[model samples]
Target chain A: MKSKIVSKEIHLKKRPAGFVTEDDFELVEVEIPEPKREGEFSVRNIWMSVDPWMRIYMVKGSRIMPPVELNKALSGGCIGQVIESKSDNFKVGECVKANFGWREYWAAHDADSSAKNITKVDPKIAPLEYFLGLLGITGITAYVGLFKIGELREGQDTVFVSSAAGGVGSVACQIAKIKGCHVVGSCGSDEKVRWLLDELKVDYAFNYRKLGESNISSELKRACPDGIDLYFDNVGGKHLEAAIDNMNIFGRIVLCGTTSQYNDNNNTSTTSGNVNDPSTPTLSSGPSNLSLAVSHRLRLQGFIWSDHNDILNEFNASMSKWINEGRIKWKESIFEGLENAPKAFVSLFKGESLGRMLVKLGPYTATSL
Target chain B: MKSKIVSKEIHLKKRPAGFVTEDDFELVEVEIPEPKREGEFSVRNIWMSVDPWMRIYMVKGSRIMPPVELNKALSGGCIGQVIESKSDNFKVGECVKANFGWREYWAAHDADSSAKNITKVDPKIAPLEYFLGLLGITGITAYVGLFKIGELREGQDTVFVSSAAGGVGSVACQIAKIKGCHVVGSCGSDEKVRWLLDELKVDYAFNYRKLGESNISSELKRACPDGIDLYFDNVGGKHLEAAIDNMNIFGRIVLCGTTSQYNDNNNTSTTSGNVNDPSTPTLSSGPSNLSLAVSHRLRLQGFIWSDHNDILNEFNASMSKWINEGRIKWKESIFEGLENAPKAFVSLFKGESLGRMLVKLGPYTATSL
Candidate 1:
């Protein structure tokens, strides 16, 4: 590895008003510092992840996580190989997953503070990119959301997943089917709908954009005639209202993401506005029929992936078994280079990504795997 | 007991278009028939209970329970004595609780069909009216909602109860306090607020009517500075929005009742309208800030008392202990005669009752105790 590697990174240029744009981020070149402290190592990034949740962190005062500081490098899930090591814990050429994404290279001490954020990856388990998608937090989120949060009963629950062609939704749909459930999914495009039906083997898939927002409930009714037993919500707003309408008695709603509301700039600005200002516009109104939660005995729960770390071992075992049996499959929409990461992220809200949206920064050099 | 008694009962005259009125009910007089069949008995009603949930049954297509038939006698919780019995199970002069309210007298065979609906009541337990208020379904609802649904943690949680001066709400406030939780309650009147703070021993109580709907969220923040951990929601709409605003991470919201939306006639009529009609007014828009459920990892669950029959024994044992320890207290706003039952039921929405509302019909004649 070069003693001083010139790495390009994306930094937050400005906060988005409503919908994020390419200009909100700037690609800048910087010097990758050396591992000077004891138990420190440097890594060359192989693959980086771009998710809808990143948009949430872009805004200040977001309750989920801290906002991305102005002019600072944006961070996310990344798979990288250790090139320089000064610690006994991490060895050279070992691939690891860390939160030092949106950059080509990163150096960090393997101390208690940063050690928890980094994990060694087995390249032989699948592929290097799979660590940033299927075998990573993305897959763990789908598994935990369905089994732990949604409590999807095998062969019994009629599961409906929104954003079914996306990373988490695609995996959740396949997992539900593998558990013998009747799966229904809704996506933005006919191409994505076909992918959901043919590739993912979902029992039913619909192009929500073609159906129009007003007909979401009716579309859901058509898809799940028996009523949805469990709903994995990735797109909130009309999708949430529709799910509430089609929910069976005692149905569960796992609140994963509100991709629809993410770009609704009105919700974001109003949330940061004067809460005491009576004139402040109502931040995106929730499902109108939420009271149905009572009449129908429904349970809607939201969860962060980090909160369920205890279930990682259990998730890994089941996920590995499914992968070995060829029961689980995933798709990635990769954008080459670090500069294209911003464009890839902006395309997410446009419903352009077929599955996991990732950016390729470098290549895997672990030939032994 | 008279062979044939002239009994007065309230019948559903016309379902109200909006909030219920006195004209919606009609007082009708009829001759009570003799208990001639085997295992049959007749009784003079002593007390009848009026509840907000009765309004839900008045609608044509309520999902919770069967709608009340027009021109038929309205049924609810009542305490009566067996004046005549030809059965081995029930004895004459024995007091029993049954769903034969809204009438001065009732006669039914103690067959399997009706036997399941009636239960022997010990007048020695407390006052006969207590059977309709503190020791009846009202108290049980509060217990189940707090412990089973809200998962009220003793001495740990910060609890908030909406409509905290009403039957279920008042009981819930006390139970939370008894469990050593920091409790806050919201009622419609200053008088009720005083009752919540002084008698129920809640940490804080606010008059929501005085605070106004716009200030509900601020009021909640003021009352629960540390944020609400568990919310016992009786009044939905603004209170729900406020609860969502002040909820801490991983908070639990028990959807006990939507007394606010129940009276919003638009919700009821639109719910019954054409499923395909886009112009059909949205049945009461839920809390506008419900997406906070995702960022905050909140859980909102709705429940019906009938579904939890298995927890009855545990509830009874705990409730009895609380009553014996003098930790449980209740208040009732009583209306005289069956004709006044309509007024009592209507007053619930008006917040005229400080606690449980009941209609007194006859007197307790079981003097053996």
Candidate 2:
């Protein structure tokens, strides 16, 4: 049966070539269906997250995860309220977070999927939008990359983070600082750099764009005079090289996202080529100084936050405590409607967003109290 | 007092720019002095080890270790018989292994140096030369890299080892096979491939030189249909790229040596360059597919065997047991005389050696019996 509620969703019009343009996405309108079957529930999304990883989903046949199908509503992190429920698992008016983003409304059966993907989030602990930012996957990504993968040495490690003003990076910077590490952050703009230094209180913050990619290694060496013990890599091209250059012995490099390479056309070429073929230069080169990993006894590890779902409860507890104690702070750059979601996602690569980039679909009515 | 005996020694003539040659070294003759001071001992060198890591020592201003001082006698792992002793710690005619290679005779105070560097070795524990090869650092290197660093899962892991007929790689192959792992080995020649398949009895053996660098990934995929669970990387560059492309989820890569890059002139440039400089292509490129580490959740770790000397006794126990059980085997390409040491060293990069390469100065005199 039709609920008489209209939903606007963003769909992939075409796969991106290099950098994503607004034309790559198409906004489609549809009617929201009422939940009729048992264990089925409908959500009216209040906030949707725009992340860099979504670009991977836009590519055809990604080895990491299945690409988003053509003309289908794109999926990501979203915070919504249960508007219709036929399931005992979800109650109407309860705030929840799910991977049904880029849409105004979503309908799903609780019994059809694992509970790990969708879960109830309390508005009393944090603002509803925070479930899409600091208290959500963004915060968990930082925690897992630092503690689990990077093996951050509290009060001892000198940590360097690239794309420090972005969602995961900003949280990573603050978390490293809170853990008493000497934190250095690199960002695209002076404003972001200022926010990293003044608000996040990072030990050092530099505008990489101003310095240019050519001087990244020297600038990183200058900022982290003692050398980086742990590098939280977000921008992976020149930034990764710079991190490799300035890394100390037994350093740990956490590969989170290659934001710098995401938009590069060269990165999409999956075919192997002859080593002597000069025309196929992109196929042969990565970080030039990777040989240094041997002499320095370094470790480079890559991980997806969702792979560590068993630690969600532990992460939530720590994050909640940090939020309550004023040890953690977050910033948001919000777009007004679902139609602006594509613009928000594109803004991430452009360095236009301050921290967690989000799209607001509707107002959230507090259900915690 | 000077003895009547004259000793010949090999000294570094100059630091090598690209590949090492005989001209980089010089032979010198000197008188062998008697041990005059208390706690002093004299040793007559018999066997000297020529290793790939020696290339790193020849480069000027290496960050990994102190470069060999210009015009000085080259020092390395050597098995020797004590000719004379004034120290209570050592007795004359006892066989000892020390880092006093490249010389016919060496004298030092036992009190001035740590005992870790010099210790009496039993000839009964295999052969005296075995202390410089399999039962020595070579065996320990493979043991530490597989069990300690690579964390090999016995009977479960599909292991890939590059330079499989070389010193450490041969030992690594046998150890993995003994542990019940399905092993794949890549070497330079058909003869070495035959040895790997026949004697080493690896699950798969391929001549990488015949396969060509460009085809390494496809060939590796064909050999390891299930994907590589652990890659003991000795030859870097294309071999590393191949391993990355064929790596399984949560795969581990133990970075032992970069044999392919040791002679590379591009590797010595420590200066940071502009990311856009076309002339500086060597400074910017490594393994183009390193980003796969993110999607596959792979980890690449670099290590040196000496750093783990704390487990020497444990390593000796295991290796001795393996040798007695006929589970371990080794091959040696020996060059006679101290003057041929330079030739033996250069032969390592040419892939001329079948297994552990050595320089034989004299024969062992069965001191253990």
Candidate 3:
């Protein structure tokens, strides 16, 4: 077997300002590092997932978690093969998942031993890449946020999902549908809207950019006349305010991410515009109508995906079953080659990617076969 | 027994603006009708409790719960004896608590029987007026807000009670004290603060009028450097904002009342004081720093005293037991007679009364010997 000394890696160049740019990352190459003295493990990267929360980490002064350091390769869950192993945790030629990312290859000292098993894609069920997308952290995020924080009760309410056609939104729509709830999603494009309503079978989907805030709020009200009972919030700002305004009594708002307010350097404004603004009526600040929460008896909670680790096993079990039943389907906007990873990460903020934006690190190896 | 006759009351007079003066009230001395035919009862007022929520009722156009209609007599709770009864739920000579108020006596047909309760105050334990104040709705409001919404876990965290020496505050301080939690209270006078610390055993007590918002927040923070774990909010405007700023992570804010904003006619400002002033300093109208609820993983829930029945039972049982044990004491700023009820009610806004504010409607003619 030809061992490709893969070392093409993407490293953090600078913390991003609001929207991330090419300057925010550095793509570098190096010879695969020599193995450690004793118990070390080597792996080859095959796939890496690009997530919206990564944008939050790129900010100058982040509130959720901490700001990513400048000049270090950012990391996340990546699928790879155990090429060489000296630890009890791994054996040669085994494929696994670990949170070491944006690199062509890695060698971990004292492998965690608990790296999840993932080799070949079950074509009869879902594509191999689906394991890294909706069926993975993205899918589990939607599941936990909706089920645990939102506390969705079947047939009892409507769910307002911001960024409704993105990875988590798509899966959340399906989960909500299974729970027999009315699902209304807000995304950036007509295609997302179509895919959401037609394929994901969300009850309603609207292009947030095209619709004004008032119209958006009213459209949500019109779509879910009974009023939103659960808000699975991904993109904050206006979406949050709209959800708060149209929430039913005892509604729950899950604050997962705020993609809209990610541009850090500008510091021009961080507002979810208010309707009461006489001059600039449209850009109401997100928390403008929050007092409505007290009257409506609303519950708004923020959550980190890591906090819900216990639900992962249950989520994997249920989501895998859904995949097998052909009830859940996912697609990825794939960027081939390690060099294009930065472009994919930046494209996330601009809504350039069609689905779960991902980077294919290399061709699948024959270890599993 | 000379049965008190049914009386008429003037409803909402001119909607009071700012301070409610005598001009804002219209007293129409109307005739008392004979006892109704069926499922009816008449109650002669014995004692009545005035509350800050009554200020909410007097607001011109409240965005939360609807304001009382103009020219309608404001309604609240009172303790009374059944002078005449035709209902299966009530009998003559029994004293009960009720929401039916304003008039000296009442004749109800098919009244809310579930809401009516006949609990004879233990004369050996406390005064009969105690049945209207600390042992009544004021007591329950404090109990539920602090115990239920605030989730006061004893010795686990500190509690900050706004209006700490008032009806609810007085009891809340005592309860938190009994539960072994450090308690900080905000009242309007030095005497009230002295009483809260000296008499009610509040760990720290400050007169809000004597200190700025920063001083109040920092004082609480200085007193409980771990930061306030539970904020039992009574005054909503600046105090709410200040308490929110000083809250610890996962803090609980019980939105019991927003009395400061209640007298404003509308919380919406002619200036509306930039709703976002506290939270988003850059934005002009962004909602106040209340979004700390989401940022700090805080849980804030506002509730009216819905369980006027259950929480009251829990509160009274707990309170009586604590009082008998000498673990708690209270102050009562008793107004002399029914004629002084209006002055006492107005004095609530002025912070003139200390401890449990009560209007001794009449001598308890039927107190059991």
Task: Please report the TM-score between candidate 1 and the true structure.
Answer: 0.91
lDDT of 1: 0.78
Better model by TM-score: candidate 1 vs candidate 3: 1
* lDDT score at residue A34, model 2, on the 0-100 scale: 83
> In candidate 3, what fraction of native interface contacts survive?
0.28
Q: What ranking of all candidate models by lDDT puts the best one first?
A: 2, 1, 3
Selected candidate, larger DockQ, 1 vs 3 = 1
Off by over 4 Å in 2: A1-6, A13-26, A29-33, A113-116, A258-284, B1-5, B16-23, B36-38, B113-116, B258-284, B346-351
What would the per-residue lDDT of candidate 1 be over residues B274-362, giving only the tens digit for each residue? Answer: 11111112235677676678768899998877678888888877877788789987876788988789988777665434566788898
In order, the candidates keep a fraction of the true contacts of 0.63, 0.64, 0.28
Candidate 3, residues A102-162, lDDT tens digits: the string is 8988877663444533332332345556768766667877898898888989987789987
User: DockQ for the candidate 2 complex?
Assistant: 0.48
| lDDT of candidate 3 over B3-36, digit per residue (tens) | 4454655465776666665566565555555466
The global C-alpha lDDT for each of the candidates, from Candidate 1 onward, is 0.78, 0.78, 0.66
- DockQ score for candidate 1: 0.50
Scored by TM against the true chain B, the candidates give 0.88, 0.88, 0.81
